[model samples]
Target chain A: MSDQVVSPRPGAQVQLEMAEQPEVLARIVGRRTELHELVRSRLPSRLRGISLIARGSSDNVAVHARYLLELATGLPVSLIAPSIITRYHHTPDSRDHLVVALSQSGKTPEIVDVARRLADGGGMVVAVTNDDDSPLAAAATVTLAVGTGRELAVPATKTVTGQLALVTLLAEAVGSSIAEYTGGESAWAALPDAAAQTLADERLLAEAVAVLQPRGTAIHLARGLTYCAALEGALKSKETSRRVHEGFSSADFLHGPLTVASDEVAVVAYGARGPVLADVAETARAAAELGSPVIGVGAPEVWNGVPGAIGLAVPQTLGEALAVIPLVIRGQQLAIATTLALGLDPDRPAGLNKVTATH
Target chain B: MSDQVVSPRPGAQVQLEMAEQPEVLARIVGRRTELHELVRSRLPSRLRGISLIARGSSDNVAVHARYLLELATGLPVSLIAPSIITRYHHTPDSRDHLVVALSQSGKTPEIVDVARRLADGGGMVVAVTNDDDSPLAAAATVTLAVGTGRELAVPATKTVTGQLALVTLLAEAVGSSIAEYTGGESAWAALPDAAAQTLADERLLAEAVAVLQPRGTAIHLARGLTYCAALEGALKSKETSRRVHEGFSSADFLHGPLTVASDEVAVVAYGARGPVLADVAETARAAAELGSPVIGVGAPEVWNGVPGAIGLAVPQTLGEALAVIPLVIRGQQLAIATTLALGLDPDRPAGLNKVTATH
Candidate 1:
């Protein structure tokens, strides 16, 4: 008997979520004035510095926030290690500290614990979460509810970009306004369209997915403000595809990890047109010189003619600073494609749950 | 064909340096009062936060310092991304900030540039490098010379531990006195012996090596402050062994990365006697349950009786806070062994220079 042909099921939940990012981000950005008022109202009269508390995809948003807040406030920003509070019981003198706590589910035990403790220690804890009534929101002084609705899939997609947009709004509320760089309020409004169009380019998306080999060494490299996309993309790929892809700043990679670059490895470079876009291109070229397959990220035009780089491109219709949204969606689509290619279900990656109660 | 083969050359420079960590740590700790005074004198009258700037192995040390400084000062501490300054040229208002910059050779251009900018922007910069006369030292308010002397191997051993000791001293100097937990000054004095003894366990070391199958996925897991060891160890192994190993906080690992754990992978857990050691053991046990081989770091007694783990043991004659030194030494030994097993030169790891001029 002749074998009957069958097509594999696309990871429906994750795929839908990835496609829903634009709407989720649009919904969050739609509440811009409200977000600003919420954050600004909770701001301590005299803020010393900012510390971000998050995990998983939210933690990647924290990286984006660290860069955004520091550049905007001219004050130090840190990504808090919750273990300092949870495991070691160190009640750091958080007075004058503005702690931005992020959690999509808002019920992660450690995130709630740290937020509660820091608030108790007199820190201004601003909780960025979807569930305004969740424990983390209760523990914080103020909650900037994500309000993006429910997110499905073990590997988060819409929530990832939604949180990214929320943080960008939070940064502006905390006094970081780069209207010239980020295209102002208009860019925030336009981000959803940009993300949707980026996903619409399935031909190029598949080409980018093709650049990633099944299971070997892979590095996601970017620099400056956009490095967050590299990190978020790497994590998503690992979570959904069961392939290990690390993220590093192109600058950091050149320092020492460049030794690992070879033809066997895939270099997914998040190269966009910005202050450090050339730096990302340089790193991609260097890795390419080492015989590494270079899959360039963000805007087909950005990488289309770049030396030794395949354009796994997205359109940066929004301004440079807002490019992170499209870049992250590119990562989400890449992960889904990679997962399907490896005959795995992105909606249900092995050994993962939607909400990780790490504590 | 005649069955003739030449014996491989053990990477002598790296091997010698690995054996010299105890001495290097002893030398750095010997200058305790001096390190304390240098950091204390440079502390601003009104300190807002601490920012650590470093690269490569030193960046791993910076991670450890981040936890230590935050706990000690009750002030926010950050690991500075040089690109934010170098690429974006944002001169963050660094007033009242204590910036601790670590570079083995003070000549790394980016480190020097950031230090100079932060210093000029009114931050107190404490330069920790071997060369007191180097540009980084010149750009700082004070320099706590890592004066463990020149490190020759591309895979630095003594400098790594030396920087570890110096950061510990810096932490104590800046205010953290974990004397009760770390066994006080005597613990500092005994750290070298602990490291030396840790290196002395060749049989256990070889067994740990055997557990790590040739050229596959490996993960170094730990929690709390000792998580720095897992990160540093992963980096060193990548630099030396060229075998990719990722590091995660045992807490963070359980979050979502546990999906990658399988029998085909090796799990090297930095399990020791401390607040979060049990959490690490739990992660190790979990990974073991997933059929991954678990190689434990630190005192044999700490992991010897732990379920589902093999002791790649080190003695913690000192206290838990001081265990990092020996744990790092264990990493160095493991890296050396891993490198040898891969039939590569650890002394001169492929494509790495003793000084990386990454700008």
Candidate 2:
């Protein structure tokens, strides 16, 4: 398995490693102030609606942004997919809508097209991207470069978190106190330390991988913004480990998916702050008792009343950080572990490609 | 395969057959008018804010109701899953909310509890159901009985359509002229005949089934009120054929799932009355051209421009009816075909029971 690992070009390898680091994350966080300043200055203008557009992990970031902005400003906000907007091209009247496009690689053709359409339709455009000179940035009315340096992994890590932070700042600028509502400032500050702490807890992570490695299927569960995170997490787990995973709202899991719980299945529940969290946790624990391995990810103190439990007390800040980095590591570990279990190469699966393009 | 067909009990078989006939459907439609009258008389009082509670297919019906009501009255409405509300039982002040629960059997424990919770909490309760004497009917402040006689198929068909029509009527009664918006009394009256005509198109039905049967995965796509119908279709497909299917809005599909489209897969696009339908049809057609077969279900003239299309045109009313029934038949056919492909009995799948219950 180790012999099969053909390392990428030296520069790309370094970028990938940097993308996995806590310090790199902190640097991305520092740029939020500038982005917020720009967004605040434009909020009072006669914008009819706001649209956040992205793809894959960036799409999840847009969802978080939409939720935050809607809660903060009570403004009409819609999460737009670049493919949906461009390929379908439902032009909102230029007089009212603002389009915000998030893309780690500002060159993704879909993102560029969506931005161009909004600009062409005379809607205000804001591009949040990791690359400053990319086409998406060039096409936008205002470009908020997410200074995340470079990202190399196919599954976005640091860039997505950076994007979320940047979007939150934008939401705040637009009079959404969601950051305050969600203890955002503290959560942002705690992220770096949280990343460091979670990584330091290698023993717990190793245990988690051990429990999850044998399972062929998993259910990823959470609510609200965390639900979006769970979906990305599930996708990461699938793409990296070649496992079948489905994401569901925490409460929704109990309605039907719970019936299929088995000893070989694992249920990963993200405990978000809500009145229903306790009930969701209890249900997760019950599933564990019923044979499915259950992993609870949330603040430690939050599980006080959760019954029949196997708790993995993830810090709130760490929960967000781990949403990206830990999943990648775990996925990588599972790949290696499963390969060894089946006597195969960890780095290569038959008929697989690192980058897939369908003609 | 013929010999493998296990006959259901006479009474259940009769009920099931009755549930599929035009007369039973018409009876349900008549009940919808009565429901509309009841709701209209009580409305202006229930107009401020509405919250709907439902589960499974019934939940989908509530979404349709929410959409039509919002369109008609411009009222604030929310569709709440029973599990979510039940989990958040601590929220005592729900008086301003009007809760409508839709279930065919009125026996699902979750639905029963939701009705009791909303009614017991002083929220207005309305049950749109077939079983007039069922517990859910008794628990509700108002019961709108479809009187569809009985439904024997494990996968619900006509009852769901009944629920949808009833909910639409209820929405109309609550201050929105949904009937008028949908083209007045004439259109509503023509629906049953349209539905029958659609069913009689056996060749189109078979073609749709053939396209859908071979796929390992499918995605049912729709938007707005029809989005809920898409969900029900996906759920039915999954439960009956044990296939992996997901539902998403026409606009939402481009976010990530489009990456998986291949000729071997199938996607069923539900066309609704709106500009979005053209975009959805075009996207589906593109997907079909890329190899995934796309089955378009809608009014004939609505998606005339869809590319790479194998179009199945049904009248608007017929489209709704065709959507629910053909899937049930397709499920049965797929199960039989797959069973033969795998050299198994058409009547049974390994490790599955006629009734599934888990503690």
Candidate 3:
């Protein structure tokens, strides 16, 4: 349990939560070894694959986990469409499967249903949550609790990044070679401090916000690991500002949706130093050349020489996988600033509750 | 191999292919038994899970297969993100896995790489393609071919629906009791007729177009089985028109992003008589209440009494799973008509090639 959150100003809970991310990351970083041991203990010995289940912001975190698991452990991953179990009543077999269930509150009914059923059917359920005693946590074989205190705002900020941190720890534990590419566990010590530096610099987020039009579809693009940040960025913009901010894989965007890229759409491309960053950069450059305003999210190096784009720089990480922590903070900042620009309260997004009860 | 496609007029290839759905469905329907036997022969002994690999429109069809496989076979499924294989070079163990590799062209480099690598890793590769002689077919343990002639148009209509038809057959074969819910293999005999009847009717799509604005975001909503239709519809619209047409899971919409629903946006809700239909209708109604124009895609029963929405009705299928065939046709028609309304050529989409080489 955590203390009640209070805002310095009226309707500023989301802003406050957004600011708390670094401290939360620091706490999570301190317990990385414990988190690793916990995940290692509960992992299925025969680990055939993974079934990830979550909703809303947590669901985006699951996508990041999918890429991590496959790349690290060579284990295929599925984000369970909870409706397949909850509504369709299909009790899918779970032998040798690991269900990474995530929820900020650990209370989404459908997620709980999925985790419980999969666990009952011979799967290992690992609950990544702020609440360690919620229904979801009870159903899990182990809980990877990364508490970000109490989140009073509807749009998740600290809680979600917390989920990302925990799942990244998960990938680090099971994936033996993941550490080599990403500076390993030793490098995680700098995560919280890097996040703080990112927060101190608002120029990149401001640059992105300055180019974004008040109307029309806003596009977000990324490849590989950073794609999750793009998705969360788009969702936050939509929820808080009521703007149609859309996200797509840099590769997936080229397949067809590239037609929508023009001056009317502001495209934000996220990347870090890794395998697919060049391709992502190329896609962003192509969109910029097509007259769409482009905002590139990465370290200064990602945009220092790139033309036709503004840079949303953060403290660079060793590899693309670990870059998600700071990139997500940048995304959340973009959403907050965008919401404020639209004269809407960032703390209270419309048509949403702290807990969305979707069955 | 198939005949070269000729158009009656310039930029009419996509329109012509859209009109050929019934014939394509008829051919696929006639060979259900053969498809069933082929799938049975290649079914992995003690199948542990399924890995679905695809991109663009073919990828949406893979999502449908995912739902079908999980609902029927009770086996977990994972959609392989090709980057992990092609970019990262991770050789995941695919033993005891059924890899459903879909590419209408079967020439996508990434899809081929994944299918080949997974097969080499011991997965049973099943290629669902229009080109039986393509690299993907060579990489497969079995190939399910559903030819619809050459797709000259940049936007695939018949080829995509053909993939849908074949995957439905694949589902029917493995998802044994899936028939009891969806009226069985015998009921598949009416598939062509049903598709023809759907094509003959155009009022529903017209109704939808009348309400869709020339500018702003268009949202497509669906749940479970019919979610595939909504995704394809959005993709087609984005490709054909330079418009922003987005898709989401009906249940997933309420969590956030609902704030974006307003008069400036158009919402299209897709459903069939299934467990989650009511929830989808509620979401559409909520969006309509927010002043966003609403289009309901399904049979007469789906929209007969529903207020605050225009209906895009199709010939009724027996159950939600079977309904995707007709719903997809309706979605394609919507995209074509939407493009025509925008003074854009449907046959030749801007910023798109027939096969997008993402890798």
Candidate 4:
């Protein structure tokens, strides 16, 4: 039951080589040309709205893309779950829409079905995936290969980051100037370095794990674009840690959720622009004063003065990169810790299947 | 810990009584008078888009309102959480939109502050609340009073139904003729009776409680407008039963969540128009066959053939009423049962508070 101890098996070196190497991930990244070509070749005659499909980590990518596209071009957008589209499989009469399907493996049956349904309905399908030859790619009218190299862990990391990059590029193609203004290209390029820096202090993260491991609930707060990142983080935490975690806007947290503060509670705040960051810090301070441990993730400007807080200096772009990795790592570690603590196997969460087919 | 002896808190009573029946809720039936008022009162002179601010049960109401308005007016609408609005308390310079805030008590401090902020920012504010004298009501430029009678329970029931009634009226006001076709008036009038009917068989619900009380995770599924009801139900169940319950569209559940189904899981399906109902029931049946207990809270047609399923018929209008009372009762009973089982007090959840305020 002791929370401290590192296991010897498939350590960070393997993850770094397989999941983080720029050259490895660059395979997916370099597919931007093919992706652009696929999208252009299958461009709709008229555009009314864009629909994005994904589930789990890929779903996070889809949501980010939706916001990025709207912010960039003020284009109308909708998110269609693969299950929904597949159930109603038919050619949509509307020719003025585009459907984008994202999956890392590109073999998920439902996603493949969704891509096919959209295409059959005469709607253009764009598949963003790591595997170019997977069913999703085959069904898609256009396939944007994410080339995230290989993901070995059951939980996704590099692929998720790659999906974010592809989404940013897609948003750029669709006329989102914010991507340009936000220095997304540089941010994307700096990911490997940023990720390396984040993992540099595994001991620091391990200490954080010690603080958080006992808690049953974690609250993640972020605003605007970063909110999506927080959501992805929370989801990973939930799936990996088996802990109840909710991702909400920092400002929103202050309104009501902060009342739950206790010494045992863990609050992770993603400091974003606007007064929300300050507000969340204040709430964290209040929680700390109440004996709760608050972990501040983001810039010092946002984390200053928070008591018993782990202030991780995550820049906006670096923040996005740093955010998902910790969550994945924490989730994996916690899953191991929890399983060992409960005398179970980390390899298998009870009653869970690797692939889900609704039919 | 014994399940057989559990009984409901005796005697049904009319909890809420509207003072002066607003014609909009009482007579107009399905008309969207409130929506029209919201649009006419708040929209920019040119009218382009809309954003909504609401929390708790009202948040669920806002989701439905957003969906209906989008379908009817084709206006881009987004739901802004009250926390987000309160976090960014500054007024926007643009007047091209409106922010509608809904609350039953209208005294929720955060909601009141958000309403004031929206009004101060020169954005049109519309308050849909039962208490006309509440702070939220006083802060709005135009307030639509839903004369839903007093609610005594901590969890909202009639107020939510009344709120939907008002939101539907608002949709009519905006010139959406869908209300007329909804058969809302007959449904509304039949609600009390339907609620009574559902409560008549306390044994059935109590048996359901036996199955649901022990579970740690639950998913509530529904489609279209009824999905909002499911969301509220899930929230109530979580808050009352002190369990982790997520509400999602029946269609959305099949995406990836289906992979985690087990015999011990509980799936509550709220059926409505379209294939979503059947799809969800099928999913539930598959889960049930796998050993999970499936609860259907809709028409029998949707629940047919699902083993160990409990069908609580709620006519569309009456559905909200029928579904909510039992939900509240079930939640309260579960809370009591779980509290006793876990040696905790039903009055307090660990690390949670009644009212949350920023430091």
Candidate 5:
């Protein structure tokens, strides 16, 4: 069962698109030299820091990138509030900053507007998207096309992984001491296989969904880089399954959100074997004690001997951050399986468009 | 009904602390010069930017500060992920950065660890806390006491507003051109009256609770500064009422969280008569059409003509960010009212402590 490759039933655009993550990640790895060269040419010569503007799934990718970039480069990275530009007509001091805008469609009005303002404020703007000719691209000093092709799914699975891959490559290229901190080059190179291993384990994900499908409300928890996975997972679940799914950092759950912990709410905790694993384990154990069913996704050590939790293994990786690549695939699969379980279309969630044009 | 300053039952420490907000805000405003001078002394001489680290209610205050500092000072602000220090054993370059840690007890382990590391990394550390001699204050270069006097409430109210006021003062002191944007001086002077006005209008909040108390799940929506209100509101509601209350930026709500909107989930939108008002209004209207009961908190113009929403007026302020001082009080009041309606103690929520010490 561990070595078997199971494919989800075809014709669901979201499932098909999500399945492309491994191949797309491999292509990004293979073309790293070219991508790096392109990035070097477009980046501001005197860039001191990086700021990102994004929303929804793209924003989750940006969050993952924030941890990746700062850990690798030791430079400050900020997620800019785009309303300061689009709503307030105010632009911060952007000089010597590399402002990156991420969107699948590149047509989100506020993001495009933010990119234009950043570029106008003398910051170098880079657009990462599937569309090469998107308005976001035109508004930026440089465009790094995600190369996921046109995504038909409203939830954005493939383009998200593609954007994450591109950011990893960018961190590897620009970071002065990435190898000293993270084996950035090798980890990016290893992403393809990790993603493949994750996608190959469709049975584990289906089993997880079988445990989770009956719950009407769920809380997804993770720490650091994987925290973004929990957020993206909750977003996918809420939109696709039409259920109440909230995501919080595992540490934060103990603070106050734990009051919502009860038998009625299921808990999903993403555990990487790291310093924070203890905190995550404690949270899961506490939630289980409170009678909530818990799903533990990571190494067996994280969930071993814990009462009332179903455990799934995380793909092997160099560091906890790199493990996010495979961890999120499980999230994507869980969303898809849950949608199917609810007899809903994962590709077209009700009242959702591929491009959320907000200003 | 409009002018009566009704108080919650005396025994509940949370209600008593919540009632302290108006007076605490006035004290912070009146002592602006001394607070500003203390901040100036502790702030790094060549501070390039600001970074904040906190968790739980303190983290929410930090979010509000991020908005305040960035808008008032035009400086890049980043919320440091505490796990990067506590779990990953990594600290990004902190030289030329001003790191601020907010806590009511000044004893949260992760936050204290983050402050110690930042100070060790050559960054200036400032502790904004209610306890002046707690470990967090001892680890910092300077401590600005919130002066709320040992809050017995598990959910922060007075200390939260005190932290926000201190950040506003810090921003005013450091900002080069704050007068060109927000009338920072006048607004600080006006906060006391605005807060008193807000607290005096208890009937409006009670009416809001009456409409919202029946719902089992809810979404709180706001944009920009008010978005922090929504988040704090959700936290207070989750801890006190034990109901599922999620918060989102109005624009981001339009992106995905809106899918959870239904007749069963009440929607609360914080609207101000400002540039982003239209977007917030649109979201309320959209949620209402989806059959969710909408509670609009702000100017009458925002929800007066909109269908399926009850309007509660916000106290007038010089700018939207300053408006948050009064806006969030309504949220705290609503949480208290909802908790009382549920026959729960607002002070001692089950399974929660005053200070959550996490690794």
Candidate 6:
């Protein structure tokens, strides 16, 4: 049994897909000019608001969208609770609102259901999905394809990045320039190479992996835009490594979940520059003081000075949202690496269907 | 040191507070008529929407509000991203929105900040907090005090129920009659005794506890209103037992997170009679088949027939939202009981403050 090598060995598809994120993102960036115009053309001239409906990793991406869209466009953005449609048979009036539904399969029953209802409610329905031929695309007023050909691994690496890229374009369409929004204009175009750099950084990734005790639980923390990275990171860890990794808004942690921190647990936090970074540093310091092993992912200055913290500085970038692209890859790599260390296959996470069906 | 018992031993405050929920809820229910009049007077003649700003356990309670208010009033409800105010200094137009901010202490800087910003945006701000003299109440146009007095335990059981009760009363203020909202007309009047009945059911709770292996992680599942119970349950387990427990929308879990379940994990699911109940039952069946222990909390018929599943039927009720109150108490008890089983103090979770001050 020990000598037999399983087909599609541990971490195979996930590693391949993670490596492909650079090319996939570059493709999205190269098409940004066309994508931006497409989004602008579909959007209502005077959008009263924006509401996003999504599930799983796509939902984490929507969290980033909520922050960016509201800040840039000065419009209130919401994450629609799909059960209100699927279970309660209710659809709050979305007239004149840009209701965006995101799904990798474009066939998740709830996501598709939400897209249809938003359209029925006079919303400007925009479907952001990987499948252009799926029912979600057919139901939407406009479809923004992710363009990632196929995602074999159930954990969803490239598709998540693809969704983030499309939402980034959506932000640009809504009158937010990358430079003004994040203070890093070149950051969008540089994402591919940045992700590649993160994927290739074996030194930090190895050190971070070594710091993880094989079977310990993990707590992820972040604030503001980078917080979505913390969530996606935790999801990846949970899906692939089958570890108990939950993410919290860093500020939310100080509220209650901080009690779970201890030497027996690993705390992974994401930070960027500014006051949010200060909170992250304090969180790391506090977690370390409680004897929890702290792995910090952010700019050097954010985590470097925190005593007893291990730091993995994602490539420096200005837009906090754009910076998350590279940071998320770091998390994906860690999850895959951790899965391999545990002798599990990242591609075939136990009992996971490629496309889960639930009403 | 070994012979001396610590004062206010760990878990004591949490247990005492849990026991106080019935009295506290009864007090709130007794005031519903007068409280309803006060809320009606404070609200605008025509509200465009509702936005709730909260953090931690209070935020989970807000999830319940989102479902109830939207289902009843046909108005859009959103859980505000507090960082948008505290960090970004961005206030999206909330002109006719009834913005409600909740906090146990009414002193969480972020919640207070959100209330002030909502007030600045021409929104009628309401504060649901335990402290009427606190800054959040001062910043708001109106305050609905939870009246839990001083909640010394870090886990926040009584105040959470107190806050839930106030939100329930607020729903009645906004066009939802207690009888029509929850199918059972007596649900509201019966809440106090229902909670008391749950607290006295030592047999079911003991069975539930025995099903929870001391060091194993637990996954909580539910749909619609009961999902909030799943979240609070997970939070209590995290705060008190120091165990890895996370809540997920039942449908969302199928998309991902289910991969983490195994023989070493326990699944605690909340269910009631509805279409959503079928999804919960299937989830329990699936998790049990994956070799995880399944403890179902709902009506007997929803879970009793599932092979290898243990059912703890909560007292039956009509409104899905109303049913959550008793279920949450069960979760709180499991958290404290599990803490005892693990030989840990629930009253003082490591490194947690009663009021977390984070920016």
Please list the C-alpha lDDT of all candidates, in the order they appear.
Answer: 0.79, 0.57, 0.81, 0.57, 0.78, 0.81
Clashing pairs in 6: B11-B347
Model 2 earns a TM-score of: 0.66
Model 3 residue runs over 4 Å out of place are: A1-11, A300-306, B1-11, B300-306
If both were scored by DockQ, which would come out higher, candidate 2 or candidate 4? 4
Candidate 3: tens digits of C-alpha lDDT, residues B154-190:
8888888889888877877775668754667655777
What is the C-alpha local distance difference test score of candidate 3? 0.81
lDDT of 6 by residue, B87-111 (tens): 8777878787888889988999878
Q: Cα deviation in Å at residue A234, candidate 6?
A: 0.5
Chain B TM-scores across candidates: 0.94, 0.82, 0.95, 0.77, 0.93, 0.94
Best by DockQ: 3
In model 6 chain A, which range of ten residues has the least summed lDDT?
Answer: A1-10
How big is the positional error of residue B200 in model 1, measured in Å on the Cα after superposition? Answer: 1.8
Clashing pairs in 3: none
Model 2, stretches more than 4 Å misplaced? Answer: A1-159, A163-188, A196-218, A235-245, A257-359, B1-18, B21-24, B45-51, B74-77, B81-126, B129-143, B149-154, B175-183, B194-216, B272-274, B289-359
TM-score, candidate 4, chain B alone: 0.77
Q: For model 6, how does the per-residue alpha-carbon lDDT over A1-359 read when each residue is reduced to its tens digit?
A: 23223446667767787888889888888888887788788777778778899988999999888888877787768788888888878788888888888888888887888888889889988888888899999889888787877777778999998888788777777755545555454877678888888888866777778766464579888888788889999999988888779988888888777887787788888887754777777887788787788888878765676666788877775467788887788788788888888888888888887777766
Ranked by DockQ, the better of candidates 1 and 3 is 3
> Highest lDDT among the candidates is held by which one?
3
* True-structure lDDT of candidate 5: 0.78
What is the model-wide C-alpha lDDT for candidate 4?
A: 0.57
Instruction: List the candidate 5 regions with Cα displacement exceeding 4 Å.
Output: A1-11, A42-46, A177-190, A204-207, B1-11, B177-187, B204-207
Between which residue pairs do clashes occur in model 2?
A: A48-A96, A72-A176, B263-B291
lDDT of 1 by residue, B205-277 (tens): 7777777746466888887778889998888888887666788888878877787777777888886677887
Q: Looking at candidate 2, what is the lDDT of residue B221?
A: 74
TM-score of chain A of 2: 0.81
| A248: Cα error in model 3, Å | 1.3
